[model samples]
Target: MFFSSDHPKHEFEESQQCKSRDAICYLCKNKVSLVEDESNAFYCCQGCGSNFHKDCLTVTYPKCHEHTLTFIRRKIPFPCDVCGQEFPDEMYGCLQCDFFVNRHCIYLPRVIKITRHSHRLSHVLRISDGDNVCGICRSLVDVGYGGYSCIDKTCNYVAHFHCIIRFNVWDGKDVEGEEVAASEADDVAPLLLVEDIDGESTWRHFSHDHDLLRVVEEQESEELCQACILPTYKTGKFLRCKECDFALHETCACLPRKMAHGLHVHPVTLHVETGDGFFICSVCNQYSCGLMSYKCNQKDCGFKMDVRCASFVEPFNHTALPHDPFYLGVDFNEYIYRCYGCRQRSRFTARCVQGSIDFDFKCLNLPGLIKYKCDDHPLTLYYDHRGHNSGWCEICEEIIEKGRIIYTCRHCFTTLHVDCILGKYPYLKCGHKIKVNGFEVEIASNNGASRPICQTCHRICQDKHVFNGKDQVCFCSVECIPSQACS
Candidate 1:
C-alpha cells in the first residue's frame, strides 16, 4: 500500500534512520518518502507516487540542501500569549499573528468593563501611549487579559478587573447617619462626591434614603464619628470632613440592617429613621443610634437593639470552640433553663430564643458523639468525661456525659451512653469489621511491643487484644473506634 521515491512498487519497510516512528505524513501511510528533487515528494501509495511526476513531488515537498536527499521533520512549540504557558509540539498554531496563544488562552473574551470607571474600555492587542494608568496605584498593565483601561488619549489609568468589581465606594454626603432637627443643628453640611479615582468625570449618586446622608467640611480637625465614633479619615470610605469631620466606615454607615437581642424572644428590624434615642446592643453591649436595629416588630414585646449588636450573626466566630458557627434566629424562647455546653443557667447567659421557644444551646462537643471501641469494652459509645459524672465532667471540661454510670464494654473499659452504645457501636476496637455472633475473635501482641498503641487515637494501650485476626488490636481510649474493619 505504501511507496518510496526510488521504488514505487516495493512494499514499505520500517526506517531505522527515522527517530520518530509515531509521526506519519498527513497524506501518506509509509513514513513520508523523501525525494532528491528541489521539491521533495512524500508518497502515501505506489499508484499516486507513480502518477505524480518528479516535478510535482518537487513542488509539494521542497529539499533544503543541494547535495544529499535527506528527510527532516520539524516540531514547533509555541508559548501562550496570555498566561505564558507553552503549547505541545506540532500543535495547531496561528502563523500570521505575533501573539501566540494556547487553546486555553484563545477563548478569553475580547472586551470587559468594570463599574469603577465611567467610560467603557475595550481590550487592545498592544499597549498605546494614551491608555490610562491604574487609578488606585497608578501602574501600567502589560500582561493581564481581564482588565479595564481608560480610553482617553490624555489619561493613562488601568485597573485589575477584580479590584474594580470588589471595592465599595461611597460619597461623604449621602451615607446613612442621624440627622438633628434644625433647632439643634450647629453648622451646615458640606458637599461630597464619590468619583472614580482614575478619571474625574464619573460619580456615584444616591437615589433613595436621603435623610441619612450629609456632608460637612473643616480645616485640620478630628472628631469621634457621629455614627460609630471610630476615628475618621478625610478621603477614605468613612470620613469626617476637615471642616467638621463626622465620619463612619462604609460598613457602619448602613447600621442595624437586622438584629436579635438576648432579652426578648422576637427579633427587631431596624431602619434608618424610626429609632428613638441612643441605645446599646444587648448581645455585644455596644452603643448605637438604635436605628436600623432588629426589634420585636410585635406590639407586646418591648425588645430593642443598637445598630452595632443587632447586626451580629449568631454562632458567629467563637475562638474557644471548634464547631460550626450559627446566628441566633428570630422567635426566641426566654424560659430555657441552661446553656447546652456549659450547663450554666440560661438567664445568666445569652440564650438564643427561636419561635418563642428556646432550642438547644450551641456547643462544639456534641457533634462528634458516636459508637467507639474502648480498652475495656468490645464496643461502646464514646462519652465525654464531663458528661459521665458532673464532677468528672466538670474537671474534664467536656460535655458528652460528665458523671454518670454510662454503658461501656467490660473488656476494653470503653464507655458510652446507653443510647449511643446500643444504637451505634458494633464490632472490634478498630470497628472496621462487622461482628457476626459466630465470627472468630483473636488476641495477639501488636508486633513485639510490650504495650501496643490504639490505631485511632495513637495512644499506648495496656491491653494487646486485636479482634477478627487483624494485625493490630490495641486501643488507647474509646475515641479511636474505627467505623469499618479491614478484611
Candidate 2:
C-alpha cells in the first residue's frame, strides 16, 4: 500500500494518490501506476517542481543530484558510485540511475582544505583517464573512483579520497562555499636578503632584531644558537648577528614566520621572545625556553611548541625507527598515547605507517652520545636493557626499569634515567635572566648548601636548576612557574 515497503505511510488516500499520479518518484525512480483516484502522500516542492516521497526529503543529498535518494535496507553487493567500491550492506540509491552510495561515502563533504596542499580541493566523481599519483601518500590514485582534485584548472594535483581524510592530514572542515582569504606576504617568508657577497648572503630574519651574515665555514667555538639552543658551529652553516652574540642555524633561521601544523587546526606564528620564559611544548611536552617558539594566539588556547618539534613534517623518517616512514599521529595533547621509545605517555607522537609503533618528540630527537659528569666517557643511549639489569639511576637513585631508554657508560657501567641526566629544562640555558609571567626570573644552579623550597608548590627544588624571581622566590621547574603575580 505504501510507495515502497521500506517507506511506510499512515494514510490510505496518500498511497492511493501516488498510485494515481503519472509522475515518477524522484528519489527511488519509480513511476506511479495510473489507476487510483485519491491522492495525499506525494510531497511536491514548488521551488524545484519536483515530487518526493514523504520520507525521502530527509535523506536528500544535493551534492549527488537535485533529486532525492531513497534509503534501502538490502544487503546485495553493489558498487558505490561515490567511492567506486563494492560493499555488501544497506545504502542510499537511485535504481533508475544505477547510482548507489555506501553509508561512509554518503556524508563526505563537497569541498575540503588540507595542510598538505595550498589550494582547496573539490570532491570529484571521476578523474580523466590517466596515471595519477597521490601527493600525500606517494601512491597511485585509482582514477575509476571519486577523489579530491585541485579546483584550479592550472593545477593537476589529485589525491585519493581516503588518503586526504586522515586525521593527521586534514582538519575535517568543510569549506564548500567559503572564499579563500589571501594572506600577507610577510607572514610566509622568514627573512629579507640585505646583500650578497661572494655567494654569501647578508639577511635580516624576522625572529631577530639585527642583521645577520651567513657563515659557511665550520668553526670550533661552542656558541649555542639563540633559536634552537644547539651548537651553531656544529651545524656547518649558520647566520651570526653582527651586533650581538645571537646566532641561528641556517635551517632554524629560515623557519616560516607563520604556518599551519598537524598538531593544531589553527595557524601559528613564530615568536622569539626571551621574556616569555620557559614553555612546555604542546607536542613534545619538553620544557624549552621561549627563545623561539610557534605560539597560537587564539584566546584561552595556550598552544606552544619549540622549533625542533615544529620542524617535523609528514612522512617522517628516523634512523632509530628505520623500519617504516611515520606519519603524524593524533595530537595527544587532549588524549593519552604511549611512545615506544621511552615507554612513557606523550602529548603527541609519530605513528609508523606500516605497524603499530609510535615515538614521542623527546625520544625521537635524543642525542645518541652525550657527555655526563659522572662518567669520563660519553654515555650511549641504549635501546634495551634486557641483558643487564644494572640496578639504579646514578643520579636519582631510582630503580632503573627494565626496557626503559637509558644512558649507559659501557666502560664505567653507570646507567642513568633520561630525565635525571637531562634535567627538566635541558633547552633552557643557566645564568640567563628571563621574564616568567611578567616576573623577572633568573635561571640559577640548585647545587647549593640546601635546596630552596619552591614558592609555588612548596616542594624542595630538586632539579639541577632553580628559577629565582626578582622577589627572591624560588621555583623548582618551569611547570611550577606561576602564571599570576607573586604575593
Candidate 3:
C-alpha cells in the first residue's frame, strides 16, 4: 500500500513485515493490534527499511518546505514541524532532512465544527495579529503558530489544538466527510440559541419562568453565576433571566439533563430548583443554593449533584494513564478511607472512588500547570515528592508533606501543599476575582497574609474564599452578600 511518486522513478518495493502482538504506528501514534486483528499487517520500505503500518503508508504529507514526509518507524524522538508537539512514536518524516509530522498534523481538518460555537472553525496557519485567546482552556494561545479559529473574520473565537478537542467540548469526530451532531441527543430541544421578544438570544430553561437572555457585555452591576458560584466576568458570555437577575455561564447552561451518574442506582434528573430547603450534595457533601443541580427524583434518594459534578463529562476516562475509567462513586457514610492522591485521612472528601482505589476530584481536576501571582514562573504538578528536603510551603509555611502530589517550581525550589494551593474545598474555585463590596477583592489564601473580614457580619472569611467583579467584591461566602450584609 505504500506508494509515492516522489520516492523513485524506478518503483521502490515493500516487503511484508511480520505480524507481531503490538507495534506502534508512526502516523497515528497509537499501538496497532498485530496478532488478534488479521488486518494488522505491516510492510518495510526497501527505500528506507523502516517498518510502517499498511494503513500509515499512505498518509504522505508535504510540509512548508518541498520535503514529502512518509510514515516510518522512529529510531529517535522527533517533534512535528507543523504543530510543534513532540512524539516518541514513529511519525511521517523525511528520511533525509529534519522535517517530521504526525498523522494529526498531516491530516488535521482544514475546518472543524464544534458544539461550543455556531460558526465553522478553520485551522489557521498563523494568528496574523492580535491576542486570540482559546475559548475552552482559558489559556493564551501561540499566535505565531496557527490554530482553530472561527471562519468569520470579525469573530474573535480561537482554540488551541488540544483544548478544542477536550472531552468536555468535542465528541471526538474529525470534521472530514462526517456530519457532526449538535449533541449526543439531537432529539431533545436545543435550549442554547433561542430568541426572546427583544430579538436577543434567550433560553427557556427548565428552572425559571422568564426566558434567560444572553448577556455579552458586563453590566454596571456584578452578577454571580448561579451554577458555578463565580462572578459572570464580562469576558465570558452568560445567560441571565430577562425577568430576574439569575445568570450563569454558557458552559453551565449546556449541562445534560439526565445521567445514571454511576453513584446512584436511579437516574438523576437535572433539577432546576428544589422546593425543599438546603439540600446537601450526596457526593461532595456541600450545601446547594438556587443553581440547577442533578437531583435524584426517586423516593428516599436524598442524593443531590452540584453543577460541577454534573458538568464533568461522563465515563470519566483516565487516558493520562493506562487504567480503568473512574466512575463517580459515593460513600454515603459507608466507607471512610485515606485518599491515594492527597494521602489525607478524611471521613469524606470530593472523591472519585473505584474499587480498592480512591482519588479526590482535586487530584483529578488538578491542572497540569498552576499559575501563582506570588511566583513569576508557573509551577508544574510533581507526583513524587520523595528525597527532597521537606520544603516549607511559600504560602502557609507548613512542611510540604512527603509522598503526596505537590506543585513545585523546580527553578526556585518552591513547593506548595495541595490544599494550600488548590484549597480544602477545591470545587469552589478560589482566588479568582468576582464582584464583592464594590471593590475587586482577591480570594486570598486562608494561610496567606491577612484574611479579610466581612464588613457587616464581623466574622472571618472562612476558607479564605474571595469573589470579585465589576460592581462588588465579597470576602466571605456568597450568603454574605448585599442581601444578608445590607440587611
TM-scores, all models, native as reference: 0.24, 0.73, 0.42
Model 1's TM-score against the true structure: 0.24
Query: What is the C-alpha lDDT profile of model 1 across 1-487, one tens digit per residue?
Result: 2334334343343232233434355322334434444344433332322222232222221111123221111244544444334544212233333334333333333343322333334444344444534443234555534344555555555654333333321111211133422212232222235554554322221212222233333333344444443334442454323333234445555443333333343334544433223344443333333224456556876555444443344444332222334333322234335444434433323222221222222221122223243332234223232343422221123444453334344464444443233222111122223222323233333335466656656666543334332554544433344444432
Candidate 3: tens digits of C-alpha lDDT, residues 272-321: 65443234566555544435777775677687777765655534644222
Q: Scored by Cα lDDT, where does model 3 land?
A: 0.57
Question: What's every prediction's RMSD, in angstroms?
Answer: 25.8, 7.7, 17.1
* Count of clashes, each model: 61, 2, 14
Best by lDDT: 2
Report the candidate with higher lDDT, 1 versus 3. 3
Tell me the lDDT of model 1 at 208: 23
Candidate 2 residue-wise lDDT, 248-317, digit = tens? 8888888887776766766678887655556678777776664789988566778888898888877777
Off by over 4 Å in 3: 1-192, 196-200, 209-224, 230-245, 274-279, 287-290, 314-333, 344-357, 365-371, 376-382, 385-390, 408-414, 422-462, 465-487
Give each model's whole-structure lDDT.
0.36, 0.71, 0.57
